[model samples]
Target chain A: MGKKITIEPVTRVEGHGKVTIHLDNDNNFERSRLHIVEFRGFEKFIQGRPYWEAPVTVQRLCGICPVSHHLAAAKAMDVIVGAGTGDGLTPTGEKMRRLMHYGQVFQSHVLHFFHLASPDLLFGIDGDPAIRNVIGIAKMHKDLAVQAVMMRKYGQEIIKVTAGKKIHGTGAIPGGINKHLSLKEKMSLLDGKDPMNADKMIEWSLGGLEFFKNFHKANKDLIDNFAAFPSKHLSLVRKDGALDLYHGVIRAIDADGKKILNDVDSQDYLEHIAEEVKSWSYMKFPYLRKYGPKDGWYRVGPLSRMNTAEFIPSPLAQKEFEIFKAYTNGKPNHSSMHYHWARLIEILHCAEMMKDLLNDPDLMEGELVTKGTKSYEGVGLLEAPRGTLFHHYRINKDDQITMANLIVSTTNNNMPMNLAVESATKQFISGQDKITEGMLNAVEVSIRAYDPCLSCATHAIGKLPLQVKLYDSKNNLIDKRTKD
Target chain B: MEKKQKILFYGYGNIGRQDDGVGVVFSEQLSKWVEDNNLQNIDFDSNYQLNIEDAENIKNYDIVFFVDASTKESVNNFDISSIEPNSDVSFTMHAVSPGFILNICSEIGEHQPKSFLVQIKGYEWEFQQPLTAKTENNLQKTLIFFKKYLKKLLIEKKIEEIDLKSLLKIKND
Candidate 1:
C-alpha cells in the first residue's frame, strides 16, 4: 500500500471540494483525484413544482451564477410553451432574453477574474495566503482594484436593471422576460455620466487583456505548461460559427481544435452525451457518446468557448481573440492558465455586446412575452459563465414537473479537472511527507482554472466539509489537515 | 463636530434552511425598522453566504454587525461580542466567516470598522423547513434588544460606550 496526500476545500473557488494524492512506498506519485463533497437535489425537489417556476426555482442552485440557471430553465420552459403556440419567444422576446443573459455572463466573468482568479495571478500563487486575496490586490494596486470593482459593479448593474436583482433576479419567464429595459436604465449604463459607464468598462476590459498578456509573457512556462494537456473542448456557437452565449448549436472540438461534432440541438443532449457515476464522489462525470467514459471526457467554459468559436462578433473582443489565437499559433491553447485570459476577452465581448443590444431599437419595443402552446418535455442550453449548462425537464398533464435533469458545467468538466489535479500533483509533490503549502496551492490553482461549482453539481444534500490527509505506506494517517 | 458613525447590519445565511435563515430574516425586519424610523447612515443587506468581496463592502462603514445563526443551546438567546480579523481565509469562496472578512477589510482598507457578530440560537437546518417557534421567539427577543441598543447609540452618538459584553450578559438574564 502507498501513502496518500489530500488537500480539502480548495480555497478561493466556489463550493466545497477535496483533493487526494497517492504516493507509492518509495514516495513517488501514483494517482490523484478531486472530490466534490456538497450535495444538492435541485432536480428531484422541483418535480412537483409548476413548469413555469423552474426558472425561479433552479436559480437557488448557485448564488454566484444563478442567472445562468434562471435563463436555462426559462429556455426549457420556452420549449414547453412553443409546443402549444406553434412557436417560441417573439423576436423582441428573444432579443430581450439575450440581453439579460449577456449581462449575467458579463457580471460572472468579471467577478471570477477580479475577485477569484486575479488574487492568485496578481499575487503569486505561492504568496502569503493571508494577503493573497482581493484585499491584498486592492492594497498592492489601488487603481486596478478600483477599476475591477467598477467593472464588476457595472456588470452587476446590468444584471440588476434587466433581471430586477443582482443575485437571484426573476426576469426570465416561460416564453420571455416579464419586463423590457426602460430608456432611463439603458441610458444610465451607456451614458458616460455614470461612474461605471459603458466606455470605462470597455476600456478596463481591454486594459485587463493587456495585463494578462504581460503576466503570461513574464511567466511563460507557468502560463503555457501548467496543467496543460490535450482534451476535447465543448461550447455553443451560432449557426455561422460565431461566439454565441445565449442561443446556438452545441459544438465539440478535438484536443487539436478540430470540429468533431457540430450543430447538435440542445433538446437531443441525451442521444449525444451520457453521464457516468463514480462511487467515490457526489458529482457525475459526463462524456461524449462516441468515445465512452475514459476517452470521452472533454473540457468546457472560457477555454472551450474560445477554442471552438470561429470569431467574436464584437470588434474589440474579436481583435483580442485574434491575438489570443496568434499566441497559440492558430491552434486551441490547451494551457489551463489561459482560462483567465479567455475569461477577460469574453468579458470584453460581453460588455461590447451589451452596448450593441442596448442601442438596438427593437429592445425597447418588445411585448415582453409570448404565450406558447404547452409541451410535456423541454430542454434548455446556454453557455454559463463557467461553461455550457443544460436544463432538461419532463412535466405531467397538470403542469407539475415529473422529472428534471441538470447537467451543470462543472459536471461536464469533472474528468478534465481530475486529470488537471493529477497532473499538477505529479509535477509538484516530491516526497511522501514533504508536502508543502505551495504544492497544495499548485493543485488548487488547477481546479480554480475550471471555476467548478460543486454546490450545483452534487445531487445529495448536507454540509460538505473538506479534509486533506497524508498517509504512509502502511496506510496510517501521518498528517491530516482540514479547513473550517 | 464628531462624525456620525455609519452603521451596517449584515445578515447572512441560507434562507432555504429552516432556522439557519434567522439572520437573514432578522435583517429584513431590521431594514424595515430602519426605514420606518428614518435612521440615517444605516444600511442593511443579506445573502446566502458571505464572500471575500464583502471585505471591500465593509470598508466605508464605521460599524458593522454580522448576524448569523448559532446552533449552541447553552448560549443566550443571542450573543453579541467584538470580533477581530484573523489571517485565516477559507479555501472556498462560497462562504466565509465574519472574522475573516474583517481581517481582509483591515488588511486592505484605509480604516477598520468596529465589528461584532450577533449569533442567534437556531434549532433546525432542514431544507425548506419553516423557522421553529423557539427560533422565532429568540429572533424577536434579539430584535427587541437591538432596536433599543441601536437607538441609544444613534441618539447619544457614543459608539465607544456601547459595551458588547455587558449587553450580552444583560440579555442572557
Candidate 2:
C-alpha cells in the first residue's frame, strides 16, 4: 500500500464534493477522483407534480442559480404546451423569458468572479488560507471590493426587477413569463439613478475584462497551463453562429476546434447525449451520444461556450472574445483557469444584451404569454451561468409530470473536473512530505475553476465541508485538515 | 435619550428537513412578534444558507442574531451565546457560518456589530419531513423564552437591568 491523499468536500463553490488522490506502491501518483457527496433525488421526487409546477419547483434545487432551473423547466414546458397547439410561445413571451434569463446569467457570473474566484486571483492561490477570501480582498482593496459588491448587487437587482426576487424568483412560466418588465423597473435599471445602473455595469464589465487581461499577462504560465488539457466543447449558438444563451441550436466542437455537431435541435438532445452513472459518486457523467461512454465525454460551461460559439454578438464581448481566442492560438483553450476569463466575457455580453432588450419598445407592451399545445414530453435548453442546462419532462394528459430528467452543467463537467484534479495532483503533489496544505488547496483551485454546483448536482443531505486526509503506505493516518 | 440600535435576525437552514428549519421558524415567530408589537429598528431575514455578500449586509446593524438548528446533544433545547469573529475562512463560497460572516464584516466594514448565535435543538433531519413533534415543542418553548428575553434587551438602558429569569427558563423549559 502506498500513501493516499484525500480532500473531502471541496469548498468555495456551490454544493459539496470531495477529492481523493491514490498513490502507487512506489509512492508515485496513481490517480485522483472528485466525489460529489450530496444527492437530493430531485428527478424521483419531482414526479407526480403537475408539469406546470416544474419551472417553479425545480428552482428549489439550487439557490445560487435557481433562475437557470426555472427557465430551463419553463422552456421544457413550452414544448409540452406547444405539442397541444401547433404554435409555440408567442414572440413577446420568448423575448420576456430571454430578458429574465439574461438577468440570471449576469448575476450568477458576477457572483462567481467577484466573490468566489477573485479571492484566489487577487491573492495568490498559495497564500495564507486564513486571509485568502472575499474579506481579505475587501481589506486590501476597498474600491475593488465595493465595486465587486455593487456589481453583484446590480446583477441581483436585474434579477429582482425582471424576475421577482433576488433568489428563486417565479418569473418564467410554461409559455412565457408570468409578468412583463414594467417601465418603472426598466427605467430603474437603465437610468443612472440606481447605484448599480446598467451603464455602470457595462463600464465595470469592461474594466473587469481589462483586469483579467492584465492578470493573464502578468501570470501567463499559471493562467495558460493550469490544469490545461484537450477536450470537446459544447454550447448553444444562433443560426448565424453568434453566441446565444437563451435560445439556439446545440453546437459541439472537438479539442482541435473542429465542429462535431452543428445546429442540433435542443428537443433532440436525448438522441445526441447520454449519461453514465458511477457508483463511486452521486453525479452522473454525460457524454456525446455518437462517441459512446469511452470517447464521448465533452466539456460545457464558460470555457466550452466561448470555444464553441462562432463569435460574440455584443461589441465589448466581441472585442474581448478575439483577445480570448488569441490566448489559445485560435484553438479551444484547455486551461481550466481560463474558465474565469471566459465567464467574465459572458457577463459582459449579458450586460450588453440586457441593455439591448430593455431598449426594445415591443418588450414593454405585449401579451406576455400564449396558450400552447399540450404535449406528453418536452425538453428545454438554455445556457446557464455555469454551462448549458437541460430540463426534460414527461407528463400525462392530466398535465402531471410522470418523469423528469435534468442534465445540469456540473454533471456534464464531472469527468473534466476529476481529470483536472488528477492532473493538478500529478503536477503539484510530489511526495508525502510535499502534500502540504497549499498543495491541497491547489488541487481544490482546479475543481473550483469549473465552479461545480455539488448541492444541485447531488440529491442527498448533510453538509460536507472541505476535509483533506493523508494516509501512509500502511493505511495509517499521517495528516488531517478540514475546512469548516 | 439614546438612539435605538438596529437589530437583525438572520435565520438560515433547509426548511424542508424536519428539524433543520427551526431557525426559520424562530425567525418567522420573531418577525410576527416584532410586527405586532410595532418594534422599530429590527429587521428579519432568512435564507437557505449564508453567503459572502451577507457580510456587507450586516455592517449597518448594531446587533445581529444568527439563528440555526443544532444537532449537538449536549446543547439545550434553545441556546444563545455571544459569538466573535474568527480568521478561519472557507474557500467554498456557497455556504458560510455566522462567525465567518461576522469576520468578513469586521474586515470590510468600519465596525463589527455585536453578534450572537441562537441554536435550537433539532430532533430530525429527513428530507421533506415536517418539523418533528419534539422539535416543535422545543421551538415553542424557546420562542416564549426569547420573546421575554429580547424584550428586556431592547427596552433596558443598561445590562444591569437585565434579569436572568428569561435565560434560566431555557434550562427549566
Candidate 3:
C-alpha cells in the first residue's frame, strides 16, 4: 500500500474543498474523498432577530442565487406567520415570481453549460485548462457565447422588472412585491425587442443540443459505467404533486423510483434527517433514519429534487424525464456525466414557462402587493438550480429576525459529491499520467454540474482561487495543487 | 407602445456585514413610501448594476438616482452643500459606479424632466445589526430629503416624458 494523493482546495464551487484519492502500488482499488472545509454560523447568528427581515437579510448569501435564498427566506417567514395565501401577492405577482425564477434557471443553466461545464466537454476532458473557459468557449463558439450572455441578461431583466433587481431584488417583500413591470416589460419577458430572437435562441440551442448529442453518443460506454451509485432525491412539489419551485409539499424518493415520503413538512426536516460531522472538515453529511450514524451521504439539489418529484411541470421537462425514466429506471445516479442533460432540460422548461408567464393577463394587474404585518418562526424550502435549499428563521415580537438556519443545496449533497470524486479516482490507474488539464477539468466540470455556488453554501468566503493544503499519509506533501 | 423609464436608486453591501447595506436599507424604506403614497410613477429595477449596459433600459428613464452611505474620504460627506453630478465616467466592464455613471450621463444629455440623488452619512459599516445610532438617526433626515426630492420630480410631472419616443438612448456611447 502506498500513501494517498491529495488535490487541495477544489476550485469552481462555492467555498473551500479538497479531494483525496488513495493509491496502491499493485494497481489495486483504493478509497477517495471530497471534503468541504468551511462553514458559517448565519443560522446561529440570526437566532433572535425579527422574522420578516430575515428574507431581505439572508439574501446576502450568494449573488449568483440570491433569489433562491430570497424564496427560501420568504417561505420561512410564510411558515412563521402562517400566511401562505399568497399574502399580498397579486395573481400577477405569483406569475411574475415564477418567471423570475425561471429566468434565474436559464441564466444559471446557461452559465453552467458554457462558462462552467463546456471546457471539459468540448476540450476532450484532458484538454488545456487555461483555454477551456468562457474565453475559450467564446473563441470556439462565438454565437453560443453571445447567446449565453444575452440569455443571462434577459433573465436578469426579468428579475429587475419583477423582483426589483437582477441579483439583489431588494423590493420583493414577503406579503407582496413592491414593484410592477410596465406593459412593455410584459411583452419583452416573452420575447425581447426582436420577437424572433426567442425562436432564434431556441433554434441555436437545438444545435447546441445536437452538438452535445454527438459527445454523449461517442462517450456512451465511459459515461454509462462511471460514478454510478445509490442516492436519493428530494425537492419541493406543487400542492398538486408536480415538480415546482414554489408552493409545494416536500417529497423524498429512493434510487429505484420508490417513494420515500410524498408529503414531508419543512418543520420536520431535522426529525426526518440528521447531519453528522467529520473532524476533518466543517461539512456535515446528512443521513436518513435507516442509516445509522448521521453520515455525509444524504443528498439534496436539482437531481435529488427531480428524483423526489413525481413528475416534471414543464412539457419539455416532462418529455426529458420520460427519457430519463427509461435510462436509470427513474434515478440519475452518476457524476457530471448526465447532470448536463438534466440541466438543459430544465433550461428548456424555463424558456417555455417564461412565455406562459408573460402571456398571463393577470401579470398586468396593478394591485400586486398584500397589506399585513407578520412576525413568527418558519421554514422555507425550494429547489435551487443546484438542489434543495432550506431557510429556517426565528423572529422577535418586533418582527426582526433573531435566529436563522440555512441548509444550502450544496451543503446537503457535499458528502455524496465526494463519493463521486472517490469513484472517479479508481479509474486513474496509470499513476504516471500527469495531472493533466483534462483530469482537473473533468473534476471541475463535475462540480459545476452541481452548478455549485459556495457563496450560497457558506454565506462567506468572497473572491475566488481559494487554496487548501494536501498532506500524504506520512504527513509529507506528495502533490500540492495538482490532480483530484 | 411607449417605454417606461426606470426610477432606480442603486444600493449595495451585505446588511449582515454591518454598515455595508446601509444604502440598501434606505432604498427599502423609500420604496415602501413609494408603495404607501401610491407613487405609481416610480419602479424599483434589478440589484447592483455592474456595467451601464446591464441597465441599458435606464436611458429610457427621465431620471436615475444611485443611493448609498457616504463618508467622503476624498472630500467630506459634509461637503454635500456644493455636490453636483459629474459626466466623465465611462462604464467599467463589470460595474458602472453610481457617482461615475451619474456624472457621465449628465454630461452628454440635457436634463430630462428631472433627475436627483440623495445620500446618507454612515457611521459604522462593519457587520452589525439594525443601523447604528447615527445611521438610524440620519435615516429619518434622509427620508425627508428623499420625499422632497421625489416631490420635486413629481411636481415637474417629469414622468410624462417617458411616453415620448425618439428620446430613448439605449447606449450611452
Candidate 4:
C-alpha cells in the first residue's frame, strides 16, 4: 500500500473545477472524483432581472457559444412571451439565425473533438502530458493537424457570415437578429460544399480512428473496446424523426431506453426538471422528473443528445449509425470513451445543416427583422457549444426585463461527470507507492470528456481562496501554496 | 508622423483567481480611457497569459505599461516599478506575463523601449470569484493613476498652446 494523493484545481479547460483522485491503502489507486466546485449565481441572479435581457445576459456566460445561449434563451422566452407568434425572425432572419447557430455547433464541436478532445484519443490518456496539445499533435500528425484546422476554419466562416463575428456577436436585440448575412458570405458557405475539405477531413479522421482501433485491438486486456456503461439520453427531437436544434421540445429517456415524455415543454421545463444544490461545490446536479437524489441520475449535452435523436442527420454521420446499430447493446455503442465518436457525428450533422441552410431560399431574400415589437418578452435557447441551454425572461408592458433564470447544460451533466470519474477511479486505483500525474490527469480528462465549460456554468470567474498542503511520512509540510 | 505613441497592453492572468486577472481589469480601464478620451494609447489585448512576441514593435511606443500579478519579495503591485531588460522575460505558460512580455520583445530585436509594471497583489488565487477586496481597492488606485495621467496630459496641452511669441510681446514693442 502507498500514500493517498489529491489533485485540487484541475486545469486545461474554461472556468474552474476541482478533481480529487483517491489512492488505496497500498497507495496505488482506489477511486477518482471530478467535482464541479464553482457555483454560478446566474440562475439565482436572473430571478429578478427581466426575461427580455436573458438572451443578452446569458450570451455573456460563454464567449465561445454566444449564439447557443442567444437561441436557447430566445426560444424559451418566446414560449413565455407568446405561444410562438412567429417571433420576429423574418424569413431571412430565420435562415440567417439558424445558419449562425449551426455554424457554432460546427465550430464548437470541431474544437472540442479536435483540439480539446483529440489528445485523449490520439496520444492515449497515459501518453506524454507535456505534448498533449495542438502543437504537439500537429508535430506528430501533420496531416491530421491540417485537416482539423481546415474543418474548424470552415465552421468559423459560418458564424462570420451569419453573425458578422466568429465567437460572440451582438445579434439579438429585443425582437430578432441585429445583423444580416451578405451574398459574399453565402458564396463562401457554398464553396465549403466542395467535397474536397470534407473528404480530406474524413480521411484524417479515418487514419486517427485506425490508430485507436489498432491500439485497442493490440491492448485488449488493458483497453476493452466494449468497455461501455449504460446511461439515458436527453435532447430535442423534431416532430418527424430528425434532430432539431433551432426549436424542438426537450425529451428525457430512461436507462431502459424509454422516453419519459415525448414532448417536454420548454415553458414548464423547471417543473419537470430540478437542479439539486450541492453544499460541497458550486455546480448543481439536475435530477429526472421521477428520480430524486436516491436514483434520478442522468446525462445531457452531446452524449445525451445522441441517445435522444432518432438518427444521424448527415450522410457521413449516418454511416456511424450503421456501424453502431450493428452492435448488440444498441445504445450509442456503449463505450463512454466513444463519446468523441458521437461528437464527430454531430459535427458532420451541423456542417450538413449549415450547407442546407445556406441554400434555403428565404436565407438571402427576406428582411432580417419582423414585427415582434408588439410585446418584448421572449426567450431564446441556444444548443451552445456544450449542451442544452435555457434563457428565460419576463418583460413588463414596457419590455423591461423583470425576471430571468439560466440553467446551463453543464449544471445538468454535473452528476454524470461525478459518476464517470467514480467509474474511472475504480478502474485506475491500484495499490502502489506512486500517485502519478498521468493517473490524476486521467481523472480530470474524464471531466473534460464532457467538455465542461465552467465559464458558462459560472457567469463570472473570480478567485475566492483555496489551499492544499502536502505532507511527508514524518508529517512535515512538503508543499503548500495558493492558486495562481 | 510621431508614430502615434502606439502601445499594445497585454492583460494576462487566470480570471478565476482573484487579482490574477489584474492585467485584464486594468486593461479594461485603459481601453475605456483610450476610447472615451481618444488618446493615442492604441490597443489592449487580454489573454489567459502574456506573449512578448505580440509586442512586435516595442520601439514604436513612446511608453508601454505592463500590468499583472506578482508575489515577489518586497514588491507589491501596489508599488509599481521599472524592471531591468533581459532575454527570456518570463510570463505565464498559457499567455504572456506583462513583465516578461516587455523584456522579451526588447531582447528579440524589437529594440528597447520605456516600460512600467503595475502588478496587483493577489489575494485568493483558486476559488471562483472576482477581485479580492484589497485587490479591488488597489485597482481603484491604478485608476487614479490613470486619471492623474489624463489631467497631466491636459495640462501639457494647455501649456503648449501658449506660444513663445505671446510671452515676447513686450520685447517686440
Candidate 5:
C-alpha cells in the first residue's frame, strides 16, 4: 500500500506548522503539503477600533515580529494622515524610524541565522539530535554562541531605546515619531563600554560573515545545492535601486533576473499582487497579479531582497554583496540555503547603518511630528527581515477602521516553503521504506531556510508539540513518534 | 552589618493575551509594591517573553525569581519550584524555558544565580480580554504570598539558605 508521512509542529522554526508527504505503494514520493493549522482573525478584531490605534493594536497579532507589524501599521496610517507615504516625516522622525528598523532586521536576522539556522549548518542534518541546538553550539563553539547572544542583546537594546519599551512600544506614530533619541542614549549606544558599542557590533558582524563564508567554502555542495529551485523574487528597493528595508518602491524579478514587476508605488500594490486562498492551509499564498495563482508565486525575504536590489548602500556590506552576486554571476540565487548568506550580509549592513545613524545629529534633534490633511485609505509596504510585508487600511468618517488587511512576510513565502518541502522530500525521502528522524529533519531544514514565522503568518496559536505519524494508503496508522 | 544580597524578579508573558499576562502583571504589581515599601536590594523586569540575553541579566543578581502563568493541571492557585540548568533544545526561540535560560547563564556567566519558578495558575488566554475572575484571584494570592515570603527572606535568612520545600508547603492554595 502507498504511505503517508506527517511531521507535526515542524521543529526549530517559529510557530507551529505541519508537513505531510505522500508516496505510492513502492514508497516513491508522490506529493507534499505544509498545513498552517491556526487561523488569524486580527483584521476582523480591529474593524471597530479607532484608526489611530491600528499600529499598537496590530502588534497584538504576533510577539515574534510585532515591530514589523507596528511599523507597517504606522506607515499605513502615515498615508492615512497624508504623511506622503514614507518621506514626509521630519529628519528626526524618519531617521529614528530607520534606526528602529535596522535594529529589528539586525536582531531578527541574527536570531534566524545563529539560533535557528546555524545548527543545521554546524552539525549535518544527521548530527546527534541531542547536540543539534544553540545549547549544543554553546558547548562546542563558546565564542560564536556568546557573540550570537550579545548581538541579539545589542539589537534589542536598540529597539528598547527607539521604541520606548520592550513590549507594545508606541514610538512610531502616524505622521512622525513621538520622541527623539537623547544625546545620552546616542552616546551610550555609539560609544558604550566594551563590546556593547556600535564599533564592536560592526566588528562582530564581519566575523559572522567570515564564519559563514568559511563554512560555505568547506561545504559548498550542501550550501549551494540543498533545495535549490527557480522562482521569481520580490522586495522594496530605494529609488536608486539600493537595498532599503524601511521604505521604497515594490520590485520583483523573474528566475532569470528579468523585471516582471517594475518599480512601482507601494500604494498600488493591490493592482500588482493578489493573495489566493487554499482549502488546505489557513495562510494565503500571495502572487503577482499578472501571473495569476498558478505561476505568479515568487520568493521573498533576505534572498529575494538580495536579488531585487541593485546594490547595498553601506560600504562593508556592499563589498560582501558583490561577492555574493558574483558567485552567481549577477543572477538571482535560487538556493534556499543561500538565505543564510544573504541574511548575514544584511546583518553587516544593519550594523554599518546603525553606526552612521548613531553619529547623525538629527537623531537627537528636530521636529518630532508633522500634521497634514487626512485621507481615509492607505497602504504601507516594507522589507521585513523575512521578506516584504504589506499593511493596508481604510477608515470611516469617524476615524474608525472599516477595513484592514495584512499580508505578512511568511504568508508571502507560503508557496516557496511548500515547494521547498517538496524538493527536500524528493531528495531525501523518495523511495525510502521507512521514515527516519534525519529524513524528517531534511524536510524541516528546507523550510527553516526562509525562517518563516508561522505565528505572524497564521496570527494564531495552538497546542504546538512535535510529532510524526506514518500511515498506509488505507489510512491505517503504521508508526508514530513524538518529542517534547 | 552584612551586605544585602541583590534579588531580581523577572516575569515574562504576552500582556495582550488575557490571563497569559499574569506573569508580566505580577512583576508590574511587585515593582510598585517594592517602590512603595522602600524595599532595598530588589529589582523587577518584565517582557513579552524570555530570550537568550536574559542569561546576562540574571548573572548580576544573587537570587532570581522567574514568574510565569501556568496551565498545567497539577499547579494549584500557584506553585513555586526550584530551577536547575537545562540545555534541552526547544523547537523554536519564540520563547525559551526558565531552566534553559539558567543553563545558558551557567555556560557563559561567572556564577549562576539561585533560581526558582513562581507559576501562577491561569485560566483564560483570549486576545485583548481581561484576566478572568478566577485567575485574578489566584494572582492576588500569589502576589500576597510573594510579598510576605520576600520580606521573610530579607529579614530572617539568607536567600540561598531558604528551604525550597518550605516554599512548596506554603502555597497560597
Candidate 6:
C-alpha cells in the first residue's frame, strides 16, 4: 500500500466536501478524488407533497441559495399549471421573477467573491489560516469589507420585497407572480438612500471588477495557470447567443470553442444530458449525452458561462466581456482561478439588469398570471448563481408530485472539480517530503473557484471545517492536521 | 417605571426541517404574545439563518436576543450566554455566528447592542417533518420561561438588575 492523504470537509466552500490523494511508494502522485460526503434525499421528500408547495418546500434545500431553488421550482410547476414554457408567463410575472433572480445572483456572487475568495487573494494561500478569512479582510481592508456587507444587504432587500418575505418567500407562483412591485417599493429600490439604491450597486460592482482586474494584472501566473486545464463548457444562452440567466436555450462548447450541443430547448435537456453516478462521491457527474460519460464531462458555473455566451446584453458588462474575450482571442478559457474574474462581470451585469427592471413601468402595473391548458409534466431550467439548475416534475391527477428530479449546479460541476483537484495535486503536491499549508490550500483553491454548494447538492446541513489525514505505505495513520 | 429600552428577539433556523424550526417558531409565538399583551419597545425577526446583513439589523436595537436550535449534548433543555465581539471566523461563511455578527456590528455600525444567544435543544432534523413531540415540550417550557423573564426585564430599570439564575429556576415549573 502506498501513502493516502485525505482533506475532509474542505473549508470556505458553502457545503461539505472532501479531497483524497493517493501517492506511490516514492511519494509521487498516483490519483486524486473530490468526494461529497453529504447524502441528499430531497427528491424523495418532494415526491408526496402537493405540487403547489414545491417553491417553498425546496427552499429548505439550502439557506445560502434558497431563492434559486424557489424560482426554479416555481418555473417547473408553471409548466404543470399550463403556463407555457419560459415565455409563457405574464409580463409582470416574468419581469418580477427576473428581478428576484438578478438579486439572487448579485448577492450570491458577491458573497462568494468577498467572503470566500477575497481572503485567499488578500492573504497568500500559505498565510496563517486563522487570519485568512473575511474577518481578516475586515481588519486589514475595512472599506472593502464594509462595501461588501452593504452590497450584500442591498441584494437581500431586493429579495425580501420581490419574494414577499426573507425566508420561504411565496412571491413566485405556478402560473405567474402573486404581487406586482408597488410604487413605494419601486421608488425605494430605484432611488433609495445613499448606498442602498441601484446606482450604488452598479458603482460598487464596477469597483469590484476593477479590484479583480488589478489583482489579475499583478498575479498573472497564479491566476491563469494554477489549476488550468482544457475541458468542455456548458450554459444557457439567449436565442441570439446573449447571456441570459433567467431563461434561455441550453448550449455547450468544446475546449476549442466548437459547438457540441447547439441551442436546445430546456424542456429537451434530458435528450442531450445525462448524469453518471460514481461510488466514491454522493454527488452525480452530469455530462453531454452525445459524448457518453467517459468523454462527456464538462465544466459549468462562472467560467463556463463566460466561455459559452456570445455576448453580454448590458452595456458595461459587454465592454468588460469584450476584454475578457480578447484575452483568449475568442477561445474558451479553461483556467479555474479566472472564475472569480468571470463572476465579477456577472455581478455587474446583474446590477445593470436590476436597475433596468426597477425602472420598467410593467413592474408597477400588468397582469399577474397567464393560464393555459394543463400539462402533467414540466421541466424548468435556469442559470443559478453557481451554474445551470434543472428542475423536472411529474404530477398525479390529485395534483401531488409523483416524480421529481433535480440536477443542481454543484452536481453539474462535479467532474470538473475532480479534474481541478487532480491538476492542483500534480502541480503542488507531487513528490513532497512534507505537505505544507500552502500545498493543501492550492488544492482547495481550485475547488473554491466553482463555489460548489454541497448542502444544496446533498440536501443536508453540517459544518465545513477541514481535516487532513496522512497514511503511510502500510496504510497506517502517519500524521493529521485540522482547522476548526 | 423607567423609559423602556428597545429590545429585539431575532430567531433563525430552517422551519422545513423537523425540530430545527424551534427558534423560528419561538419568535412567531412570542411576537403574537407580545402583540396581544400590548408590549411596547419590542421587535421580532426570523430567517433561515444569520448572515452579514444581520449585523446592521441588530445594531439598531439597544439589546438583542439571538435564538436558535442546538443539538449539542451538553445542552439539556436550553442555554443562554452573553455574546461579545470576536473575530474567529467560521470555516464556512454560508452563515455566521452571533459573536461574529456582533464583531461586524462593532466594526461598521454606530452602536453595538448587548447581545445574548438563546439555544433551544433539538432532537431530529429530517426534511418536511414537523417538530417532534419532545422538542415541542422543550419549546413550550422555554416560551413560558421567556415570558416571565421579559416581563421582569421590561419593568427593571437596569438590565443587570434581572437575575438570570432566578428566572432559570422557573424552568422547573
Q: Write the per-residue lDDT of candidate 2 for residues A1-484, one digit (tens) a residue.
A: 6778888877677777788888876667887798877765889988998888888778667667878888889888878877221136666677767777787788778777877788788888888877777777778877777777777666666777667755446777787777777889888888756455778888888888888989988999888888989999998888789998887889999999999987798888999999998899889999998999889999999999889987998898999999889866898888999999999898899889888888888677778777745669988888898888888899997778999999998889999998899888877885554667778878888988998888877755456656788887777998888777
Fnat computed for model 1? 0.39
The predictions' CA RMSDs to the true structure, in order, are 3.0, 3.4, 8.9, 8.7, 2.0, 2.3
Regions of model 2 farther than 4 Å from truth: A83-87, A192-194, A360-364, A430-433, A472-484, B1-5, B25-29, B74-77, B127-173
Candidate 3 residues B1-173, lDDT tens each? 34655476555545655555566777788888889888765765434323323333344565565555665564233112212443322211122355434432332222332343445676774335677777676767666656775675577766545321312121111
**Evaluation by DockQ, superior candidate among 2 and 5:** 5
Candidate 6: tens digits of C-alpha lDDT, residues A1-484? 4788999888789888899999988789999999999988999989988899999899999999999999999999889889988799999999999999999999999999998989899998788877888878877888898889888988998999899999889999999999999889988888998888999999999999999999999999999998899999999999999999999999999999999999999999999999999998899988889899999988888889999999999999999999999999989999999999999999999999999999999998989988988888989899999999999999999889999999999999999899999999999989988889889988999999999999899888877567899998778998999877
Order of candidates by TM-score, top first? Answer: 5, 6, 1, 2, 3, 4
Between candidates 1 and 6, name the one with more favorable DockQ: 6
TM-score of each: 0.92, 0.90, 0.73, 0.71, 0.97, 0.96
**Alpha carbon lDDT at A246, candidate 6:** 90
RMSD of 6: 2.3
Model 1 chain B: lowest-lDDT 10 consecutive positions: B87-96
Evaluated against the true structure, the overall lDDT of model 5 is 0.90
Best by TM-score: 5
| Chain B TM, every candidate | 0.89, 0.85, 0.63, 0.71, 0.91, 0.88
Please write out the lDDT profile of model 4 over residues A1-484, one tens digit for every residue: 2233445565445556666554444555455455556556655555556565665555545555667776777565545544362233566766677777877786676666666667666777777766665445555765555556566656666666676543235565444566666667766667545532434445444554455456556655434332246676676666564666676677878776788867666656667777777676677677766777656766777666667777766676677656645543665534555566566666666766766776687776666555432444444454565677766566676555666667777777777777777766656645434445565556666677677777667666533222333444444555564433
For every model shown, the clashing-pair count is 5, 19, 41, 47, 2, 0
Clashing pairs in 1: A11-B91, A39-A460, A84-A373, A84-A374, A85-A373
Best by DockQ: 5
Q: Of the pair 3 and 4, which is ahead by DockQ?
A: 3
Candidate 1 per-residue C-alpha lDDT over B1-173 given as tens digits, one digit per residue, 9 for 90 to 100: 23534888998877766788898899999889989999888888787677555776788788899999998776578888898887555555566779878876775555688898999999887656468999999999999988887787778887666557756665666
A1-484, model 1: which lDDT tens digit per residue? 5788878777777777888888897778888888887766778778898898888878667667778898899888988887222136776677777777787788778777877788778778787876777767767877776676667667767878778765457888888887778899889988846456888788888888888889988999998998999889999898899999888888999988888877787788899899999988889999999989988889999999999999999999999999989987888889898899999999999989888888877777857787756779999999998999999999999999999999999899999999899878877884545777767888999999988878778743334455678887777998787655
Backbone clashes counted, model 2: 19
